[model samples]
Target chain A: MVIDLDRCTGCEACVVACHSENNIGMSTPEEAARGRVNHWIRIDRYYEGQFPDIKVKYRPVLCQHCDEAPCEPVCPVNATYHNPEGLNVQVYNRCVGTFYCANNCPYTVRSFNWFDPKWPEPMQLQHNPDVSIRPGGVMEKCTFCIQRIKRVEDQADAAGRPVADGEVQPACVQSCPAEAMIFGDLNDPDSKVSRLAGDGRATKLMEELGTKPKVVYLEKAR
Target chain B: MKHLFLLLLSVALVVPCLRADQPILFPHSTHINKVHLKCIDCHISADTRDAATIPGVRKCMLCHAKIAADKPEIKKLAAIAASGREIPWQRVYGFEKAAAVKFRHGPHARHKVACATCHGDMPNAITAQPLVKHNMGTCISCHRQNNASDDCATCHY
Candidate 1:
C-alpha cells in the first residue's frame, strides 16, 4: 500500500469503509468517551504551530503488516502470524485474549474486543458476510482486507490466470474519494504500488524501529 | 446389567426418531430413478454458485401441474405455488456460522467430484437426509488427495 499525504483531505471515508467492510463493532457514546471506539483505519491528526498560525496534518494509520512483525513473536498462542501472501493474519478462534501482541506493536493498531459485538435491529443486516464478526476477548486489526484479496485470487485461480495489477483493492483504498491510497502487488516491478515505493518522497512511518512495514507514505509537498 | 439393558433399549428407540419430519416428504428416489431428473435440474446453482439452493414450489409445479395433479403431495405443492409462499425446506447440511466455513459448490462441481462424494447416494434414498458427515478432516483429506489448497483461509475466512 502506498499513501500520498498530499492527496489526503482527512475526510475519513476510509475509516467508515473499513468499519463496514470488516464488520467492526460500533462503540456507544459512553464507550466512545472511554476511548473504546473500534476503528481499523483511523486518521491521526497532527497540529504544527499554535494560535492563528496553526497548520494541521493528517496521517491515516492501520496495521503496518511488518516483515519482522513485533506482534507475531509476542503472541503466545500463535494466533497472529505472517501468512504466505505476506499478510499478518489474526485467527480469532485461536486467540485466548492475551494482550502481549497489542503491547509489542509499535503502531498500536490492534484492538481488543471488550464486549460481544451487537448491532441494533436493522444494523445487523448491513454486516459484510465475508468478514467474521469477531467475538469478545479476541484481538483484531487490519488484515489488508484479506477477504477481498482471497475473493479476487479465487476468481483468478478459477479462470487459470494470475491476479492482474490493481485487481485487489482494500476497502480503504477503494473508498478513498481523493484516491490517496494505492494497493497492489509490491513484488511486481511494474505495479503502481511498487513504482510509488521507489518515489523520491516515499518514506516508511518509523524507519528507526526496523519493522520493515510494507506501507509506504509519500511526504506532503512543501 | 438390567439398568444397562434398559439404557441401551432407550437409546435404540430414540435414535430413529431424531430425523425431523419435512413439511412434505420429497421422494428423491422416485424423481431420480423413475422420472430421471438430474440433481442440478432442481439445484440450478450447484454448478455456478456458492449455494446449491432448494428449488422453489414453482419449479416443482412445472411438472406436477399435469403429471401428478391428482396426488396429495402435488396438490399441496400446487396450493403453495398459488399462495406464492416458499416451501420452508429445512437444511440437511450446512456449517455453523461460528465455524466460518464458506463452502462453494461451483468449484467442487466443476472439478468433476461426484455429488455422491459428499452427499452420498441421494437418488437412491426415499427422502432427503444427511447421508454423510462433513467435518474439517473430511475436507482436508479430500484436498490432500487431489493436491488442492488446504490453507485455513481457503474455506474459513
Candidate 2:
C-alpha cells in the first residue's frame, strides 16, 4: 500500500489498528525512553526548519517487503523469506535471534522485544485472535496480512471463483479513515496500488540500497 | 467390562469441560438458546473483515433498555454505558506472544468453522478456558491435512 505522506494527518488510527491487528505490544515508558518499542508499523515524525516556520511530517515505516529484500539473503536459517505475494515474511520460531535481519534492514523497520511484552491483564484480552504473538528473542516483521490473503483466496476457491482485486486489504488500509492507504495487486496495471506506484512522487526508502521495496511512498510536492 | 466401558464413555463425554477461562463468561446458550439471539447480533462487526467483537454497552443497552431493564447485570451495564467507560473484555482464547501469527476471525467464521471449533462449545461455556491448544504443530498439521499452506510464513510474519 502506498501512503501519501502529505495527506496523512498522523491521526494514528493506522498505528492503533496495526497494534490491534498484529498484536504489536507497547513498550514501557522506560523502554520507550530508551527507543526500544515493538512497532511493526510506525509513523516517522520528522521536524524540519527551525523556530517560527517549523514544519513536521509523518511517514509510516514498516517492513518494506522489498522484492530484493536485504534481510532475506543474510538469514542463516532462512527464517526470513519473500512470499510469492511480495511479502518479506519472517518466521518467528525459525528465527534464531541472530539480529542479522535487523542489521540488514535499511529501513530499520524491525524491532526486537527486549523483554516479555505485557498487556496488563485484561489489556491482553484485547489482543487480536488472528495474529500470533511474538515472544522475546525472536525477530518479527510485517507479512502484509498473508493470513487474510490466504483466507480471501480460500473463500474464492470455495465459491469456485478467482480472487478479485481489492478483495483483500490489510488492517492498516482498512482502518485508515482518510483512505490514505491503497492496497491492491501491483502486478495488474489497473490495480490501484500499481497505478499509485507509478506516480511521479512515488519513491522507495533508501532506493540507493537497491532493495526494490514493494512499498512506495508518494511524496507531496511542496 | 460393561462398567469400565460406561466409565470411559462418561469421561470422554465430560473430558472436554465447557468452562474455560475466557475474559468474559459470555453466556452464549442463554443469549442464543433462551433469547434466540443470533451470533452476529451482539457481534455486529463480524460481517466485515474484522471479527464480530463483543458489542459495547451501548449495543447492550440498545435492547436491554426494554428487554432486561430491571435485571441487575443489565442495570449495571446501563450505568457503565452512561459513564462513557468502555467495557473491559478479557480474551478467552488467543495466540501468545512469540508465535508472531496472524489469525483473522471474520474469514474463519465466514468459512463455516463453528465458533465451537476453536472456542469450544460456547453455548455451554461459563468461563473461557483453553478448549484447543494452538501451537505451530497443531496449526500446520491441520493446514497440511486440509491442503492449506503449511509454509512457516503463512502464519508467522
Candidate 3:
C-alpha cells in the first residue's frame, strides 16, 4: 500500500469505509471517553505554524504490515503473525487478548475489542459478510482487507491465471475519492505500488525503527 | 447385568426418535437412485459458485409436478411453489459465523473431489444429516494431502 500525502484532502472517507467494511464495533460515548474507539485506519492531523500562517497535514495511518513486525514475536498465543503473502494476520479465534502485541506496536494501529460489537436495527444489514464481526477479547487491526485479496485470488485461481495488478483494492484504497492510496503486489516491479515505492519522495514511516513496513508514504511535494 | 441391558436398549430406541424430522422429507435416495439425478442437477451452482445452494421449491416441483402428484409431500411442495415462497430448508452442514470459514463449493467440485468426501453418502440417505464432522482438522488434513495451502488467511479472512 502506497499513500500519497499530496493527494490526501483529509476528508476521512477511508476511515468511514474501513468501519463499514470491517464490521468494527461502534464506540459508545463512555467508551470514547475512555479512548476505546476502533478505527482500523485513521488520519493523523498536524498543524504547522500559528493560526495566521497555519498549514494542516493529514497522514492516513493504519497497520504498517511490517515485514519484521515488533508485534509478532510478543504474541504468546501466536495470534498475530506474518502470513506467506507478507500480511500481518491477527487470527481472532486464536487471540487470548494479552495486549502484548498492542503494546509493542510502534504505529499504535492495533485496537482491542473492549466489548462485544453491537449494530442497531438496520445497521446490522450493512455489514460485509466476508469480514468477520470480531468478538470482544480479541485484538484486531487492518488486514489489508485479506478477505478482498482472497476473493480476487480465488477468482483468479479458478480461471487458472495469476491475480492482476490493481485488482485487489482494500476498502480504504477503493473509497479514497482523491485516489490517494494504491494497493498492489510490491514484489511485482511493474505494479503501481512498486513504482510508487521507488519514487524519489517515497518514505516509510519511522524507517529507522527497522520494522520494514510495506506501506510507503509519498511526501507532500511543496 | 439385566438392568444395564434394559437401560442400553431404551437409549438405542429413544435416540432415533430424538432426531427431528425435516419440514418436508425430500428423499435424496429417490431422487439420486430412482430418478438418476446427479448432485449438480438440483444444486445447479455447486460447480460454479461458492454455495452448493439447495434448489428452491420450483426446482422440486419440476419433477414432483407430474410424478407422484398425488403424494402429500409433493402437494405441500406444489403449494409452496404456487405461493412463491422459498422452502425453508434447514442447513445440515455449515461452519459457525465466528469460525469465519469461507468454504467454497466451486473449487472442491471443480477439483473433482467426490461429494461423499465432505457430505457422506447423500445418495443412499432419505434425508440429509451431518454424517461427516467438518472441522479445521478435517480441512487441514485434506489440504495437506492435496498439497493445497494450509494458510489461515486462505479460508478465514
Candidate 4:
C-alpha cells in the first residue's frame, strides 16, 4: 500500500474503520494518557517550521512489512516472520509476549496491551465476528490486512482469475475518504500502487534502516 | 453427615450452573437453528474481516419487519431503527487486552474449517456456549497438528 500524503485530509476515518473491522482494543483514558493506545495503523502527526509558517503533516504509520524486517530476525520464538506475499504476518497464539519483535521494529508500530481491554455490555455486539480480540501482553503490528487479502485471493483462485488491483482494499485503504491510499502489487508496473510508488516524491520511511518496507509514502505537497 | 455431604454437592452443582447462564438469552436456535439462517446472516460482518457484529436495526427490521410484527421484541428493533441507535451486544469472546493477538477469522474460515467446528452447532443451539476453548494451548496444538504456522506472533498483535 502506498499513501499519498498530499491528499490525506487526516479525517481519521481509516483509523476508526480499522478499529471496528480488526477488533482493535480500546485503551482506557488512563492508558491513552500513558501513550498505550493499541492502534495498528496510526497517523503520525508532525509539525514543521515556526508558528507563522508552521505546517502540520499527517503520515499514516504501521508495520512496513519489510522484505528484510529487523523484527523477524530478533524474535526468540519466531513469533514474527515474512510471508510469500510480502506481508510480515503475526501469529497471536504463538507469541510469548517477550516483546523482542516490538523492540526490534524500526517503525515502532508494534503495540503491547498492558491490561484486559473491555467493551461494555451492548458495545461488544459490534465486535467483528471475523477477527479475534487480542489478549493483553502479546505484541502486534499491521499485517496489511492479511485476512482480507487471503479471502480475496481465495475467491480469485476459486474463480480461476487473477486478483484485481482494487478488489481487496484493506480497511484503511477502503475507508480513506480522500482515496489517498492505494493498494496493489508493487511488482506490477501497471498497478496503481506501483505507479504511485514510482512517483518522484515517493520515499520510504527511514530508508537508512535498510528494512526495505513494501509501504511507500509520497512526500507532502508544498 | 449425609446432609452436609448433600449440601456440599448441591452447592458445587448449583452455584456453577447459575454462572453458566448467558448474560442474555440469545436464543440461537430460533435465530439460526430452526430458521436455518447462516451464522453470518446476523453477524454479517463475519463474511469479511470482522467478528460478532451487532447488526443494525435495519438489518433486523428486514426480517422482523414481517416475521414478528406484533411482538414486544420486534418493537425494540423498530425503536432502535427510528432512533438510529445501534444495538450494543456484549462481546462474548476476544483476546485479553494483554495478549495482543491479531486473530482474523476470514483466513481460518476460508481454509475449510467449518464455522460449526469453532462456534459449535449455533443454528440449532438455543443458548450460546463457549464451544471453542480458544486458549493458547488449544490454538497452538491445532496449528501444529495441521501444519498451520504456529509462530506466537502469528495471532498475537
The model with the greatest lDDT is 3
Docking class of 2: acceptable
Instruction: List model 1 lDDT by residue over B1-157, tens digit each.
Output: 9999999999985553344466676888899999999999999989777778899888888888898799887787888889999997777898776666778887898788899999987787755678899998999999999998876666766
iRMSD for each candidate structure, in the order shown = 2.0, 3.4, 1.5, 5.0
TM-score against truth, every candidate: 0.90, 0.64, 0.93, 0.63
Question: Which ranges in model 4 have alpha carbons more than 4 Å from their true place?
Answer: A220-222, B1-157
Provide the fnat value for model 1, as a fraction from 0 to 1: 0.14
lDDT by residue (A26-46, candidate 2, tens digit) is: 788888889887888888899
lDDT, candidate 1, equals 0.86
Docking quality of model 4: it rates as acceptable
lDDT of 2 by residue, B1-157 (tens): 9999999999986655544343333556788778887767877756445555777777777787788678766676677778898767777556655555666565566666666666666666444456677776776776777776666666565
Winner by DockQ = 3
lDDT of 4 by residue, A1-222 (tens): 899898897888988888878877787788889988788888988899999999888889988888899998888887778766567887775678888888888888998867655765666789865466767777767777766776687578556799998798999999998998988998888998888888998989898889898889998446
Tell me the DockQ of each model, to 2 decimals.
0.39, 0.33, 0.57, 0.26
**What residue pairs are clashing in model 3?**
none
Task: Using lDDT, rank the candidates from best to worst.
Answer: 3, 1, 2, 4
Q: Give candidate 3 regions above 4 Å deviation.
A: B1-20
Residues B1-157 of candidate 3 have per-residue lDDT tens digits of 9999999999985564344477787788788998899999988899878888888887788777898999988888888888999987788888887776678888888788899999887887766777789999999999999988888877876
